[model samples]
Target: MAISPFRIYDIASTFLQHSLHLTSTLHFYARSKNEYSHGIIYVRRLSMNLNDYLLNKHLLLVDDEQELLDMVVSILNEYGFYNITTAKSIKDAIEATQKLRPELAILDVMLPDGNGFELMKQIKQYSDCPILFLTACGEDEDKFKGFGLGADDYIVKPFLPKELTFRIMAILRRSYKSENPIVKLKNSQIDFSSAQVIKNNEHIQLTAKEYDLLSALYRNAGCIVTIDALCEATWGANPFGYENSLMAHIRRIREKIELNPSQPVSLITVKGLGYKLIVE
Candidate 1:
C-alpha cells in the first residue's frame, strides 16, 4: 500500500505526541511506500534525545531556495544542531566542503548553476560524507540517479519538520556508528552509553543537563569550549541567560567526574573563557 506524504505526516505527528508523556525513550518505527516506490521509509519518533551525542556534527545544506534554507535551518536549530553551513549554489557548496568537511550533506536537486547530482560528485572528491537529497524532484529517474551516485537518502520537498529531523538523525546514526561511547578521565571514566561515571569502582549517574554539558565538553576535549558554545549545547538554540544555570551544572558535573571539585585536575575552567575536559 502506498502512503501519501500527508498520511506519513499524520502518523509521525501522532507518535511524536504520544512519545512525550513517557519517561523512558521509545522507538516508534513506521514503514511506508511513496510514489517513487522507495522501499521501507523509516520514520522514527525523536524521543531518545540523541542530540547530546550527535549535535556537534558538521552539516552542509545546499539549496537554491532561500526561504526553504531558512526554514530547514530553523528546524535543525530547534533540534540542537548548531554546526550547520548553508550554500545557495554548487560553487559555494563545493567551496564550503573543501574548506571544512561536513559529516553529512543535504542537497537540493535543482540549483541555479548546477544540479545537486553534480554537486554530490564534486563533494565526493573531498569527503565521503553521507548525502541526503532534499529536493523538489520526485521523479523515479531522479531518485535512481541520486542513489546510483551514492546518495544516502532522498526526501521530496514540502516535507514535515519532524520527518526531516528524524531522517537526518537516522542518517547520522548509520554513518557515524563508530563513535566510542566511553570517555576516560584522570579519576573517572564516563560511559555515555549508560550515562554513568565509574569512579573508583563506584557508579555515579549523571543528570540530563550534566550529560549534555559533559558530552559537549568531551567533543572538544583538551580545547577550550567557549561558554556560549557550552550553553547552546546544553540549553538550546537561544542560550542567553543560561550562564548561571550552566555554572551550576558544571559544578555538579565536577563533583561527579573530579576527585576534588574544588582543586580540579580533570575538568578545568579557563576563568574568562570556558571549561576543558582533561581525559586520560
Candidate 2:
C-alpha cells in the first residue's frame, strides 16, 4: 500500500523521533526532583502525540548472553516498542516465536545446545516474519552462510547500536514492500520474494545485504563482473577509495558458494584484479 520511499522514511523517522523524545523525557524526569519529578504529564502527552503514529509491530530477540540480550531489549524499548521479548537459548527462542508470533526476530548464530540457524529453519515452517542475525562471527563465509540460509539482515558483533537500529528499520521496510522476491544461484534457490532460501528443500534466513550481493553475482554468472561492477549494482554507486566494501561483499559471497572462502570455487577472485562467477 506504500509506494514512496520518502513516505516510508518519514514514517520511520517519526517513529524514531517520538521514541527518542519519550526516552529522553522519561530519563530526564527520573533524574529530576521537586514538582517536575511528576512529569508524567509530558510523558503521557508525548505518548498521546505518538498514538496515531504507532505501528502495531512486535519484535523478538534471541541471544545466549544475558547482557547483550538486555542491551538490545533496552534499545528497542527506547525506540517506542512496548511489545518486546528476549530468549537466551534456542529452545526458549522457539517457544517465544510460537507464542508471541512477533513481526520481526533478531537472532544470534551460535546458541547454547543448538544453533540459531537450525531454529530459523523451523520458524520458517509457520512464520514468514523477517529475521536479522546479530552474531559475533564477522567472517565473510559466516555472513554468506547466514544469508544463504535466508536471513533478512546480518550485523556482526561489536557493532554500533545506531547502525543496528538503522538496519532493523531498513529490513522492516523491505519486508512490507511486497512479498519478498527470491534470488537464484547455481544449485540454490533464494526467495527474496519470501525472505527465504532453499537448498535441498531446506530453507534458511539471510541478511538484506547478503541477499543483494548474492543476487548480483547470480544474475551475472560466469561474467567477469568487476568489483566496481558489483559495487554499483548492489550499493547504487561506487564510492571512490572505498574498495574495501566491495572486497567485503565478495568475501561474504564466497563463504556461501565456496567450500572454503579463503580458496573459493564458484566465486573466484581475479587476483590483483576484480572477480567473476563460475556457475557449474
Expressed as tens digits, the lDDT of each residue in 128-154 for candidate 2 is 998899999888998888899899988
In model 2, what lDDT does residue 103 have? 82
lDDT of 2 at 86: 70
Best by TM-score: 1
Global Cα lDDT for candidate 1: 0.76
- State, as a TM-score between 0 and 1, how close model 1 is to the true structure: 0.57
Give me the displacement of residue 246 in model 1, in angstroms: 9.0
List the candidate 1 regions with Cα displacement exceeding 4 Å: 1-49, 181-213, 218-280
lDDT of 1 at 35: 16
